[model samples]
Target: MTTTASNSLQNIVIYTNNKISLDFYKPFEDGLNPILFTVKTLEQIPRKTENKIHIVILESCDELSNLQINCNKIHLIMPAFLKNKLENDLHALIFKYEQSMNSQQALENLYHSFIKFYCSAEYYLDPQDFFNSDSYKDGYRCINIHEILQDNVSYEQQLHTYLNTISNTETVSFNFSIGYEFSSESGYLQLIENTVDHLTYAKDRDVFFSVVLSKHPLSDNRLAIVHLSQ
Candidate 1:
């Protein structure tokens, strides 16, 4: 699948290690509404839109450049000290997992690091607050959740937690609103349980797999999708 602008201008925010890039569909036009801000500037950008905004944080500018070839609507930004802390945490987790000699344990460590990084840095809304906000009116808004993992079980557990929590009633259509970055086929199936549902995987070399859940099994009123990548 290719990244295309649906309609109207969507606001996107990105945080990275002082460098990044974006890639999107061709026929790129002007007037994109995304804002690029450093982590330090997050407080300056008050009144963030709920449904119309997207955010991404890369490890470095080179990663950003690689992303530019695949996504067009991304708003690349630099992270504050948080990025460094997250990186340090990730490094420690990875190193520990590698020494354990268990691939599954390693993957779990990576997944946990990913979740912690996003929850602690990018997403300002608490889980409860996110569900209550007007931005969640149509359901959960689409968000790209990324993580680098070393094993499958850890990834699966993370998916289970995310889907189960977001789909809960208090979430008010939260499951239908977000996308994910995953590393395996089992993880994908775990998120989309039905064989009847159609899955659209992206052709971009950088994106490993993607699926948009048009409807959630728990409720017909809510819609959601998940995107995964290695």
Candidate 2:
């Protein structure tokens, strides 16, 4: 199918408890249109529609748990802490079926040294604008999740491109460092250990694949390495 024809068949439906102002998602309305719906109403929509639905859950509701198991179809957008907790709690059993193939290779590559930093609420709340700004891209290049969501492709395809970039890096050992005031190297190292453990198990999960550094907690000309892959 042509790119335009394929894009017309896909759209993002974000399910949330309360009705969020459409204005928040206004900028992303092009290409893959974004629509908001509550869990109750989401069920009411026809299941056999022409458009391929990409579900994004804003807040967890009990009714959505069954659908949540299919990570490809349903995406949960909770706080960074909550997502981390879920990754720690359920990652092992969730993808146990593929352990034999992925675990060993993933283990040997542990020394690659990667880190996924959680963006501050300020950045995530208006990710479109923050990602578009030159300030965040001053030190290094990044893949903007907001912009990718606006594209005519699936998140998985975009993720594949990102993983390929990591694999193609010239050096294996990468480090993520923040300014001294916000955290010490030891504290940051501990956080990285915990995050990598969860990440190692559920590497393909999109929620666990962020590299954006927090913009708040330090508002100066200080430079922080959000991600380092060489």
Candidate 3:
């Protein structure tokens, strides 16, 4: 989605991949340039200017700490599968707030908790939870992107069923942290197309990447893409 910022100018810098739709940004495009970048590598991204309030939207938290950019506000776009945990947390908090005697007082604390846990950080996600193995071993190895996708390949069976209900063919990205016990092999996967330049990855492994393919809303036969947790 969308992030609210306190800027008269409403300046923004959006990072995207093919899967997410930028149509949601049409209204703000005229007032400000809203610097945008297609996520592939950090080097290609334009450098951030100083003392400016801009919204930065990124696909994964993998490069969040690595990137040396400053912005007034940031939005971490996430995949559909990953939203469950955060939503569950919110629902749980709302329930807790409803039950508490000091509901009004607790609401303020809840707001701060939300901001601090998910929003206030330099980046919204932690890399260790997603890619790093916090085991006894000190060294790590890069897992092939193909292997990552293949491990979750069973989702291919229902790929067509999901694509058939594509009322919106715009980019909707997502972000989530994978725990130390996290294993890609356990998740439900729906693969579309998996063709990247190289299969070997290190920093990128921290990113759980996949794509969803469907027909364009207007165009015929042409495919629309959605990157999972990109």
Residue-level lDDT for 97 in candidate 1: 23
Each model's TM-score?
0.25, 0.27, 0.21
What's the residue-level lDDT of 164 in candidate 3?
35
Across residues 67-145, which tens digit of lDDT does each residue of candidate 1 receive? 4322222222232212222211110111122232333332233222222222222222222222223323222233333
Given candidate 3, what's the lDDT at residue 174? Answer: 25
Q: Rank the candidates by lDDT, best first.
A: 1, 2, 3
Lowest-lDDT window of 10 residues in candidate 2? 88-97
Q: Compared with the true structure, what per-residue lDDT tens digits does model 3 show for residues 1-230? A: 12322223222333433233434333321222222323333333445333222223333345444544432122333321222122211101111222232323332232222211223121332222322223112222111111122223443333344433322311121222122232343331221223222222333332223221212221211111222221
Best-to-worst order by TM-score is 2, 1, 3
* Residue 52 alpha-carbon offset, candidate 3, angstroms: 4.3
Question: What is the C-alpha local distance difference test score of each model?
Answer: 0.28, 0.28, 0.26
Distance from true position, residue 1, model 1, in Å? 23
lDDT assessment of candidate 1: 0.28
Candidate 3 error regions (>4 Å): 1-8, 17-20, 26-53, 58-73, 78-230
The runs of at least 3 residues in candidate 1 whose Cα sits more than 4 Å from the true structure, single-residue gaps closed, are 1-6, 15-17, 24-44, 47-51, 54-130, 134-230
